[model samples]
Target chain A: MVKRLSVLDANRCTGCQSCMFACSRRFGVGGLAYSAIHVRSVGGIEHGFVVIVCRACPDPPCAKVCPVDALKVRVGGGVILDAAKCIGCGFCAKSCPYGAIFWNERENKPNICVYCGYCAGYCPHEVIALEELG
Target chain B: MDEYLKNILYIDLSRKRFWVEDRGSLFEEYLGGVGVASKILLEECPKNADPLGPENVIVFAVGPLNGLFPLASKTVACFKSPLTKSYGESHAGGRSAIAIRQAGYGAIVIKGASETPVYVAVHGKNIIFRNASALWGLRNSITVGRVLREIEGGAGVRTIMRIGVAGENLVSYASVNTETYRHFGRLGLGAVFGSKKLKAVIVSGKTMISVSNVKRYRELYDKIYTTSIKSSVMKKYHDLGTASNIIPLNTIHALPTKNLRESSFEYAENISGERLAEKYLGRRVACAHCPIACIHLAALREPYVTEPYFYKTTMISYDHELLYALGSMIGVKDTEGVLKLIDEVEKWGVDAMMTGTVLAWMTEAYERGIVGENEILGLKLEWGSVESYTKAIEYIVKGVNEFYKTASKGLDALTSRYGGEEFSLSYGGNGMPGYHTGPGAHLTYLTGARHSHLDSAGYSLDQETLKGKQLSEKEIAEKLYHEESWRQILSSLVVCFFSRGIYTPETVCETLDILGYSFNEVELKRLGEKILSNKNDFKEREGFNMLNQRFPKRIFETPTPFGLLEEKTLYESVKEFYKILKERARNS
Candidate 1:
């Protein structure tokens, strides 16, 4: 079984959003045009950072709310985006509690994580990791 | 593209008017940020403009890669330094780069001095100038940041850049504090700000950037990003940050311990990164878009002596410069004690490096009886004594007495008055950096533009050369000259000198290509040479005479980790380098 992508420990995060950039870069876009994850300060940066990404709920709201069926749950990964099927409804983005789903207006589609674990590889601080859970 | 939005914002506070100028030619020639700022300063800023006068414009610029790339988000401040009176430029990573880029402008040039205290808040397209009489004379930097944050609209997006009391008082080495922790430190741009009567500048912009080739840009960015994160060069910075250098510097006996009187400290380990992480490391933060969060915040959680239920944790950013300055420079052993002093200095908005150097000088003066107990304003000056130093730092900030006044001016002023030029620890009128490595470091500081360690990082080169035996005077001079010349590109790109390996000449050329500019290796070298010459021209026009250059004899007397530096050879080598620079300038 493959694992989902999430930041395991917040303390380890340097608040360097290489993870966000990696996700955006994997989508073949410049800037944070189509990244699904967001890293922000908890309150004051002195307090540290909070990594907000999809938990890949059992009944994924992002997958459920996609009217065009663009977002579908993969066997191991939480939600995968079929760019061709996305109708730019932005419903999946609104439904996600964590606001993990990102919509690029230029492309007019919702960007969801495929749980490829590529971003984890780039995190030198080990803030992000892939772990299999029942 | 709208031309007005892309143009540089020029605000003259003395005249109380603003205008937008088309920098298309300059921007086309050298992209935005450090590149364009330097060119504009050279072109517009008169060679003889008073460093603290309204004629000297303070330029805050952002690059093409600023909001477009992950880690390239850094703002470069260009101004005639009140500290060095040379070509002064300082780069800081925070919301500054992103704010300027998003505000739909490349650079903001602030000229003239206001009649009264004022703060400019740039929110998107609207810029409002507010009277800051109430905010002026604030003791704590955090209070200034907090007040500005509340008053300014964009809580997360906006950056409140406020100068502390040190800047208000026109301390020669005052620094402008941004987002509490990050600073465009060095060269005293803060004093320039103070001279303008401009207390603070808050900026926020949410504008998106456009890429020339989105697909190709992404591919190239990932290639850089993947390798950048995984690069061995980044491992130390990413993991332990620059604070990790303390241990290594201690091992080499070149840590600038006790104002260079001693090369190494017995209490070095107490303030090292390992110990800090164990005792005080709270959390790490990044700049606007950088993924390599190399910033370390020390969590100072202490129980209130009077009220046990009421406790507060103060988070302070720890770096090598700060550690060396506040720790080893004054012989500080207690980590918390050092942090407390550092916090006080930051609250006052002075250059941490200058403050350390000044306090070190004062400590030495006390020991030598150059300054007596009466001159000390009743505060005891002692090494490894935080209480005395803390009071001294306050006195420096307030400019309370003759001692504070002299110290606040800088080491140069203090040394001249107190007859301690031998151990002043200043080069080119600026306070010294933490490099007692070798002659290369000293020469680099002596000759580099702005007299900063970042100009060439000659210490790194010196360390590399130490593997070989017997480096000639000429060899060292030439090496320093060449590296300092090339650093023009690094500052122009506004690239962090730490990532020199990542942004190689090839990568710089390639990155510029994506921005619709093309330059070969030769062209790049020529550009660097031209910028170096331009800087020299500015310095020469400002009455800088290389022949009259003074080297502190104390350095020669003190033995370094390398060896006891020979004064005659060092002085002669510097003269040769100075001659070379002049020849190049004349020919160019």
Candidate 2:
């Protein structure tokens, strides 16, 4: 069984992206310099917001495009990144349909969500939730 | 640090040469954004400088946290305002902060005026003066924004700050629109732009930033973000937007209706946020990195009068202020009517609050028989008559006649000439923001440096005192002083006051720590006081006087949610405020 996190209700999202910022902060960074996820206004903002995060697909394209084998499937059915092996080629970042894989140009690596569920705990709007599927 | 800040960009249309100068020490002491910008204006701008002349400098500045942090997304624009003739500061969120930061510089200083129509474009670090000959006369603000977006690179990353026909025509209360919906909405910054023959300024940058404590910064960033997004405190703003204030205000009988003739509207339900959301809400949007996307857009699906298949549906942004000004203040019952008026005002780039107040003045003028149809350019002006008022607004923007010119100057000129100061509804020459909340709001508008609602948030004090007791004069003055003092710090951090609870004095100190500026709670208070003094200095240099300042008689006429405000009491309250400020200034 692998757990996936999703923003089921966007109206509930304050657009605070505390989750994405938190993930980058959890990596011990000061700003959004290297956050794994991005929250952007969808189609000119009168339309509300869309949270772009990994869907934890069984056919995860991010893992498939990792030429250096830096990304692998974790025990919980989520993707994990071995940062030491990443060449920062941005191939996986380009392959991510959801654009969840963030590139940190300064550190030369790809930042990915590991389903630690750290961000879900901080979402004040209950906009993000982690669920397990068998 | 020294290499990052180069020459301050000086564009003088009167002189026609754009030059750069060095003024870096001011930044180190005052910090960038409001503090440094204020100090610079006071030092450079001469006494009694004609606000609409080539002398007044418009400064656009970004703070240290900008580009480095996701939430550091506010840009502080400082200039001597044509509206207040005092130090004017307006902070806007959008791509403004990011654009300035990415341009690899902290501040831009613009002076002089252009003889012909022009605009400025800054890409990376290079600056170019573009001939805005064709774009100069556009009435629609969004049209100007769209044209700039298409012609320029960095569509999403850049900020297109343009003035509409209102600014081009020197409307005293004109605002500069950026990112389509966001504005430097107060104190006639747009009029200054218009006076300079400058139509617009576009900024875009794509530079990387270095952080000191990457790990700790990330940790704190995550903590703040999660806490903010998940908090129920933001629910009201996110869902219904500021329109949520409509129901509560109406419930309290504080909704200013029909130019303060009534506190609440009978057809308030039709114009309430609850109604707008249910009937016309197209979507909710957020400003650049902010999770509390409080921007609400209404879908105006109207029939095309010419063809059945050619229906026009436009999405227009709405908020509490617009709802109050265009809705209750003007006696508008139809949400669609309110939306149409709001859209038109925004397109023309006039300050919505001032425009509403101006319309309210015209409505009263018609009622009082001060002006007639010939003066009105044949538009039948009436309260709640959106059809006629819409035409009047267009005429005002186009500067159709002498009356339109004065109306465009703001209510002060109209009242001064026409004898309607009693109900003119202006404070320090700026129109009243929703809520005749009480003496705090009135006194703040009367004396606060900017004459802006955000200056001291006096409305908050009124709400607090509403719990069955009127505040003593001394007590009210103290509260206003403390609040305005603290807001100086908030504006320095450029934090949104709406999120004051989460970013308490303690949190503000901690956030400053991340940027290596450590100050205790007490020190933060002192910094705020110093900044307040600096702003007052700018006002004093411009010869701003509290004496002989016009306090609208309309305020006394209209009974508020709290009570009918007495003239003697209000004047006494204002005197008390002035006396305390004078004493404090002398001591400091």
Candidate 3:
């Protein structure tokens, strides 16, 4: 069994960005420079918000786009970054259909969610959660 | 001071130049947001500068708590108001504060006038003045937003603030719409933007802020977050949004209706929050870092007459202010009717309260035979008629004729040109708020720096009176002064006022302590007072004489929740407020 983060319903998203803050706060600071999960309006906010994150594919396209074999597959459905091996091409950022791979501009590296489920806890509306896969 | 908190970005639109200056001591003294913005406004704006001229300054500032704490989620915009022709300030909640803070700037001051329309895109260390001549004549604010959303990046994190045709035409109460829902909705910020030919402002950033103490920081964050989620008041706010006040206010005879001819509405039940939520509540949104999702949008479906088979659904945001201003004030009884009117106002990006209040005045003037069909462009202005009102709103934005153009100038210009001075509802030259609570509400409108009801929240004082507590004029003035002065602290920290109950002085000190800033409760109080006096300094410097505007006669005519208001009581209260303000100004 493997655990993964999931957006239970984007319709419940309020655009508070608490989940984003929580994701970034895992780095022990309050700023949002390193958040993997993101939520954006579908054109305009009146239309409502859509939560974007890695859907955890069986074989992620981000791994294939990695020229340096920096992204290694985790046991579940996502890839884990090997920071030392990454050449910082940002191909993984463009390759991800969800645009979930956030970038670190200073270091030129990708920030991948570690399936910590920390963000799900901060979502006041129950819009996201952690689930187990069989 | 933190290095990032000291950076101020200055842009001159006339020269198309931009620069960053470090002002650590200013932020250290003032804290940021309203405090810093107000200080900058006083320094940058010339004496008797035209509100729409190149000399006027526009300051967008975020506080230290933004991007680091929950509900510290507002950007304070300080400028000279075209509407009041005096000191102007408005607070907007969206990603604005967070974006500005993250973008490596404490504040952004925009000066000078552009020959052609432009929108400034600001990010970390880069400010791009993009030509926006094409977007100048866009049909609506939403269209302008849609066009800019494609040109600018940072979809999730950035804030795009833009104005509509009303702003382009220098409507006195034009609003700067942000994120399609929230706005700098009062005091003519949009008009200021128009004067400078600034169509929009885009801000987003990539930055990391490390805390002084990570463990203590997380603890405080948890306390604040949990406290917000569990509070019943927050629950009420989240469920119904601010529209929850409609039924209660009507029942208490505090809801202003029919241009405040009556305090209560006959059809209040139809436009009540409960009804609107049950029928048309489409979505609930929140500002960045706010746990409470108080922004409510109603799904309004309209069918094209040519093709009745297909209907388009437009999402319109609503609150008690819009409910009272556009709904009850103008006599619109039904929920959908109010939504339609709000849609029109939102499209034009004018202050909805000002627009509705303006229409309400015109409606009464037309009915009184003060203005005939010729004055109203041959359209019969009727109360509660959304069709007529929508057309009137379009005319206001289009400046179709003399009356339509004068309509956007607000009550002063309108009353001066036309008769109906007695029934004209305004407070200190600005359109009146929806409250007819009592003298406290009236005093806040008159004596508060910006003439905003939120300045001291005197309605809260009126609620105490409703509970059968008798207070004297001096007591009321003292209370208003204390509360308003204290609120300067919250605004300086830039926290949402909704969480005032939760963020006590002790809690505030704890949060600040973890941020490497230490202040005792007494010191914090003094800081708040100092900041407030600075705002008053700006107001006085701009030559706004509070005694100039008298209360409209309709206030005494209409029976309020407190019965017919006594003119003597209001006069005495205003005098007391002035005395307090004078003493404070002298001491400062």
Best by TM-score: 3
**Least accurate 10 contiguous residues by lDDT in model 2 chain B:** B1-10
Alpha carbon deviation, residue B111, candidate 1 (Å): 1.4
What is the TM-score ranking, best to worst? Answer: 3, 1, 2
Worst 10 contiguous positions by lDDT, candidate 1 chain B: B1-10
Report the candidate with higher lDDT, 2 versus 3: 3
**Clashing pairs in model 3, backbone N/Cα/C closer than 3 A:** none
Arranged by lDDT with the best first, the candidates are 3, 1, 2
DockQ of each: 0.32, 0.25, 0.83
TM-score of chain A, every prediction, order shown: 0.88, 0.88, 0.96
Alpha-carbon DockQ of candidate 1: 0.32
- Residue pairs that clash (backbone atoms under 3 angstroms), model 1: A16-B291
Question: Could you give the C-alpha RMSD of every candidate to the true structure, in order shown?
Answer: 3.9, 4.0, 1.4
* DockQ: the better of candidates 1 and 3: 3
Name the runs in model 1 displaced over 4 angstroms: A1-8, A19-29, A32-37, A52-134, B1-6, B155-157, B586-588
Number of backbone-clashing residue pairs for each candidate, in the order shown: 1, 29, 0
> Which is the better candidate, 2 or 3, if ranked by TM-score?
3
> Best-fitting candidate, measured by DockQ?
3
